[model samples]
Target: MRNNKEVNAVQATKTADYCLAIIRGRYPSLAPAEQKAAFFILEHPESAAEMTSVQLAAAAGVSESTVVKCCQRLGFTGFSQLKLALVRELATSREGAFGEVEPGDDVPTICDKIFTATLQAVEDTAKVLDPCEVALAAEAIFKARRIFFFGVGSSAVVAQDAQLKFMRIGMTAHSYLDTHAQLTQAALLAPDDAAVVITYSGRTREATDVIELARECGA
Candidate 1:
């Protein structure tokens, strides 16, 4: 039997992980309000902890209802409860906060700082890029008889790029944006085949369905 605080803590942990996963996978597809909420939480989590629903809504340029809804969607009871959980998460996670800039910084100086920050972001990303995972993916693709690429919107561009690269290398790769086309390809994918699901928001129902169908066909 967990107390309210304990239950809230557990929910917060789950919500934090869920939000991070969504931001990593489906950020590009987030609605404007959701995107703003996501970025605020990721970039300035400490501040997010102190914000009231109204203040946070103003910061994100969303309605208070949106803020409440976002909190509920993330598994918190409401804004206050979400803030409490955020505080706890921030205390435990050692992730660096994004540096803030004053409005007075000159353009060139700000540009240089932004450039340095971008480099740091790239370095951080590279630290987690496992070579073993790359090798495994390459092996899977190389040995598969066929490949289906799934993505939507901007991610669709990335999927198409992957398809083209594989095709240029003489692999049978197909990328689809339409529901019917994806369904057709997914239905045809076999146990000997593989599928590369590409979506920033791994939650896109249509794209995810295609990936699911591919697995159903034993890809």
Candidate 2:
């Protein structure tokens, strides 16, 4: 069994810019009560981050334990840890601004919000993305015999985009959006294969299963 250190390290390295994306990607796979908490968080990341587990429970209309379990289901140890992560993301995320959109807002206001939020999101992400991490990842990709992109939902589109770009550059790349195909390819990978899982939340059960299977096959 993995130790707490391993589990925490794995969970701690999740994407900071796309918590809502993550929630959405894995939302369909979560328990019903957890889905309620996820819905509350997606629409109210700031409020949810500031709330206690009990308060979140009240807001999400579920039990406190359900909120806690939701956190666990999303790869967090508990509410406070997830809350802190959300707060960090919120400070650097454009979704916070977009989350405040009202149904009655004008089209001009909506367009402006989207444009500015997208620019801000890019700028914020650039500030935090490490060049060393990019270099290491690139080196690994270059050394691999083949590259596989594993994703679901919107992330699957991202995987396909990546595959297209890599193939254009004459690289051996493949993307599997279908869960069954992803599992099949993962089971068939060789020792020198490299797979990048592209889910924003990094908590999708199907994606995680593919990664594990690939790892077991020495990918």
Candidate 3:
């Protein structure tokens, strides 16, 4: 028979996975202020789980109301519920899928860990995606006259790959490695154009500039 501790561990794992999946899946659609709070929770789930709404808002450089709204957007009742979910998730993650490699680990062990982490990431993403949002985004892209992809550092590689794929399908797509070129392209975007900003962390100045300019130009 399972002990109380084992049962609690399993429950925590399930709750944590659900909470994290929601945050990841809805992140792109959140407002800039709400995204700030959500990104903080994603990057510091353990710390965020322990913080009050005001404290989390301060840490994330957003307002307290933003934090509350972010929680609501994720389908939580309030900050308290979000905190509870994060706390449970952190409890189960202490040595779970996100575990880091130790110096003494073998190559096979490292490979296994990498594969496990990759699988877990994919599973979490699959859980939180909203079908409506996906369909809307797909339809927008399908109808766009041109598409602009923006990114920096490693994300730029992804942007370039996307640009190549779209071009292969006979769509006009652009991805610039230069910041100046990106801004220039963004300024020329019309209402019929679409822009996709790709970044691991949503706080980069370059990405913010591109998004703002693209929106201003009615992309």
The top-ranked prediction according to lDDT is 3
lDDT assessment of candidate 3: 0.82
Badly placed stretches (over 4 Å) of model 2 are 1-32, 35-52, 71-104, 116-133, 152-154, 176-181, 200-206
- Per-residue lDDT tens digits of candidate 2, residues 1-219? 457896555446663445555565566678888988888998788788888899989998999999888878777778887887788777875465434456998999888877876775575456545566678778889999999998999999999999999999999999976889988998999989898988766678898998899889887
What is the TM-score ranking, best to worst? 3, 2, 1
lDDT of each prediction vs. the true structure?
0.71, 0.79, 0.82
TM-score of each: 0.56, 0.62, 0.64
TM-score of 2: 0.62
Candidate 1 residue-wise lDDT at 79: 77
**Global lDDT for candidate 1?**
0.71
Kindly indicate the candidate among 2 and 3 with the higher lDDT. 3
Q: List where candidate 1 sits over 4 angstroms from the true fold.
A: 1-29, 39-44, 58-64, 72-85, 88-143, 152-154, 164-182, 203-206
- What clash count goes with each model? 4, 1, 0
lDDT pick, better of 1 and 2: 2
lDDT of 3 by residue, 1-219 (tens): 457897666544544467876686667778899989988887777888889999999999999999999988777779998898877766766423344578999999999988876876787866555455678888889999998899988898999999999999999998999888988888889999999999876767889999999889887
Report the C-alpha lDDT of model 1 over 100-184, residue by residue, as the tens digit.
4669988887887688667755754454344656787788888998887878788878889999998998999988777678778
